[model samples]
Target chain A: MFDSHGFHQTAMAELAVAAQVSVGQIYRLFKSKEDIIEALVHDDADQWCGEMAEIQMRMDAGELTIVETFEQLLLHTIDEKDEALSFDILAESFRNAAVADTIGTMCQRFRTYIRYFACAANDKLSGEALDAAEEMILACLFGLGHRSLSRPRLSASSAARLTAEMIVTALGGVR
Target chain B: MFDSHGFHQTAMAELAVAAQVSVGQIYRLFKSKEDIIEALVHDDADQWCGEMAEIQMRMDAGELTIVETFEQLLLHTIDEKDEALSFDILAESFRNAAVADTIGTMCQRFRTYIRYFACAANDKLSGEALDAAEEMILACLFGLGHRSLSRPRLSASSAARLTAEMIVTALGGVR
Candidate 1:
């Protein structure tokens, strides 16, 4: 209903009718329409955080390459069949400050993970080179994710590989 | 009203009050709230198109470099101060497939302009080199635009300069 009618169009009365209950029933469950939307947003965030945590654990165990970690992340974000809750939230973030704030926090958290992975992958780098490497990785991840939304046919695996190669190449040019 | 309360939150009665007329007056002026929003969007788009057309004319006349063209585009978008409109519409887009359709059309138009500018800037490029250069420019423009919303302090001029440098450096690598 939210997807079809939007946040404002899906009123309490309509929700009641759709759920086969009275408006009062909805009030008893959710304080307001905004509350329902907040709940949905929180649920989506939790799911994404869980996925990132799992990836981080695998990386910590030294079971995943930097390339494999990023490929999984991109595939998780852009694979057509996946439930892209983060992507959905990001698309709407431009409109909703709350959504933007949530996504920003998530991005920061992801950046830390990317930085750690980059350092792990290329242990020889430090200072400016490492920072530039981290920045390029983040940029590529963000760029690829944005492009995938518009061009769904772009292979997620290939995109991730290319992004990894580009970051390495770009970093090499920094010094 | 749409900036603060959002499209759905702004009641017809409030608009009528703000316009100093009866509720019927608003309906007479705009068939629906969506119509009002569309008008606003069209007006903003027209303004941007006008500015971009002027910039294109100057570039074609050899009065502006590719870097200058990019700077003008970025500065214009940032200076508009209609971030709210873009945000609101983007949020609405996720819910309405029609919004996505509109965005895709806009993207194609922008891509054409990018290609034109790129061709003019680097007349010697051909084949894969041309494709990569175009892709890099598009990515930089769109990626930086997306980032600008979160980092408003990052002036369009600076971003454009950085983007121009990055694209030139990337192309240099390819060469």
Candidate 2:
């Protein structure tokens, strides 16, 4: 709804009314509409990062096979909430700096977290090798999720096995 | 513009006016808004398939390295037209049978094309192994392209190398 109306058309007063918060309170806490947008983006990113960390921990502890870990990642990334949040942020980011900054911060943090997990998943990976592994994993999964938006999707389990196998073959160290 | 207004808010009359075509002409050619949307989706998918066929030919001829081929694919996929087209069709597909059917057709065609290319790239890969490889290539590239939307992207060339190398490793053959 906000996307349809756009940030520009949707005023802070209207937002406060819609949110059932006093305009004074909205301004007092968020400072401005842009700040409010930034805060929401941050909240969404935090939620995603939190989920990713849990998945990473499971991977680190070897609770799931490489494929299962990938499946989990795909399910989360392609899940409707995450997909909507990503689309919303990307749509807004083109003309908005605060949103972009929030996203950049989130993605940077995500990179750090994923890199750590990639290493933990297989101690054999580190340095540049680890970086590539992280990039490949993230990029591939994002692509798969985006593709699923309009077409038939691979089952999460199937995608996980395929991805896990690919990563193992590529990196040669995942157990 | 359609995305900002959304599929529902964008009227056929408005679209016809924007395209400088009469409503009668629009209806005669496209049948309805959903048909017009399907036509657009088909146009984009056809263009993408054409591009892929060319890449496969070059790869088959040894005129391009796997990395170069991948870089070209990324440039095309992440190109503004493709991304916007994909997003538009996807946004509409959630509720429209015409759009969904159009996407289904495009995906089926794409799958056949990708499968053929995979085998050509590595005659040794077939059946399940080939299937897995095809899935990996497409999915990873999609993910990489999607990530690039919000984050700084790797040079198309670097991404090509990274993706090609991963696919080769996964499939264990590429000539």
Candidate 2, RMSD to the unseen true structure: 4.8
TM-score of each prediction: 0.66, 0.75
Top model number, TM-score: 2
Candidate 2 lDDT over A1-175, as tens digits, reads 3454544456889988988999998888988777877887788779878988898878768897665776677677655443433454465554466676777787887787767656655778755556667777777666666656535455655655666666666666322
Which 10 successive residues of model 1 chain A have the least lDDT summed? A80-89
TM-score of 1: 0.66
Instruction: For candidate 2, give the lDDT of residue A32.
Output: 78
lDDT of 2 by residue, B58-166 (tens): 8879998765666666666554543433544555564456676787788778877777766655778765566666667777656665565446445655555565665
- What is the C-alpha local distance difference test score of each model? 0.59, 0.66
Model 1 chain B scores worst on lDDT over the 10 consecutive residues at: B147-156
- Please give, for residues A68-125, the per-residue lDDT of candidate 1 as tens digits: 7766665565443222333333445656676667656655666567667666666775
Considering the true interface contacts (CA pairs under 8 Å between chains A and B), give the fraction that model 1 also has.
0.07
For candidate 1, lDDT tens digit of each residue in B47-97? 666777788999889998776776676555435454445556655655556
Model 2 reaches what TM-score against the true structure? 0.75
Per-residue lDDT of A98 in model 1: 68
